[model samples]
Target: MGDDAPAALVEIVRRWADDPSLLVQRAAVAAICEPRLLKAEGAAAVAVDLCGRCTLHLVGLPLAERAGSDARTLRQALGYAWSVAVAADPGPGLGAFRDLDTSDPDVGWIVKENLRKKRLARLL
Candidate 1:
């Protein structure tokens, strides 16, 4: 997967981000959240995009649908993943994070969790 073209890789990640399975979505976030991967040219933007898609997937699910262990796994992965992407590309990354509608409890929790990260605190 890492050897694929950047555009193709991003597309694949997008699909994973959109997948119904929370474990698959967690994999997508974990795949791109690596600091080394984010250092590659244009990788940060791709990470931010994919992360945003994953967040949307979470936010769109009904509250009842998010009660499973799979959802918790995805939420846990996202809790710290935003910091990596934001540190990699503050402009687009922060923009994407800030663009989320935090009124939704899940989105609010994700945003608050990212804000608590020291990495993001230092960036801010």
Candidate 2:
């Protein structure tokens, strides 16, 4: 889906990011985090946007709602996925990451995790 039509892939990823299922949300991040796919024109921006959306969803959930294995998996995927998108296009990618509400613990953790990556750490 990302090869011939990255925009369509982004749209689908957006929907998946908003899905109620945490695994589906994880899939959204995983799908867009592919380095090759992110190299596509404009794909990095969409990837960052979807990451932000998924992060927001996770942060908004109640504590109990976020404790499941699926949520943990999503969080783990997001830990490194942001760096991939930012590395692909730092301009919009970093801008989007900065736009996130990091005061939320989950969002803060995700930000910190991504910042730990050498790719994104070099930007800071």
Candidate 3:
């Protein structure tokens, strides 16, 4: 069971690394599984991690199955949403996100600008 989860996750990540479309990225979310023997043993369930820090739990739907679904479309939409969130969120490790309006689809485009303005590489 434990082995299955890592294998599946690796497969998905490999697929994503090739082309790197939002569809494959979202579908590659990791799932953890455990054994359960009903009442006495209790029930074990599988969970997928969307982002390591965020922990967006994906409902069942495996990567293979999602390939046929509207996954690509959903993934694009989610990527856009993530960018928007990243832009608006004013938290640590996200100092690169401030000063952006959600209207722009390329919200992450500002990262380079931030780096340039701060003269980070120039310091080196």
Pairs that collide, model 3 = none
Whole-model lDDT values for every prediction: 0.84, 0.87, 0.32
Q: What lDDT tens digits, residue by residue, belong to model 2 across residues 1-124?
A: 8888888998899889889998999999999999999988788887888788888788778899888788889888999899998888898888888887788777788889998999998986
Q: What digit string (tens of lDDT, one per residue) describes model 3 on residues 1-124?
A: 3343545544444454233344444443322112121111111111111222111221224647445545545434333333332322223214323333434333233333334433223322
Which parts of model 3 are misplaced by more than 4 Å?
A: 1-60, 92-124
Candidate 2 or 1, higher TM-score: 2
Off by over 4 Å in 2: none
> Which stretch of 10 consecutive residues in model 1 shows the poorest summed lDDT?
1-10
Q: State how far residue 123 of model 1 sits from its true place (Å).
A: 2.0
Best by lDDT: 2
lDDT of 1 by residue, 1-124 (tens): 5545656766778788888898999999988888877777888887888788888888778888898888888988888898899999998788788888889887788889999998889877
Flag clash pairs in model 1.
none
Best by TM-score: 2
Number of clashing residue pairs, candidate 2: 0
What is the TM-score of candidate 1?
0.89
Candidate 1 overall Cα lDDT vs. reference? 0.84
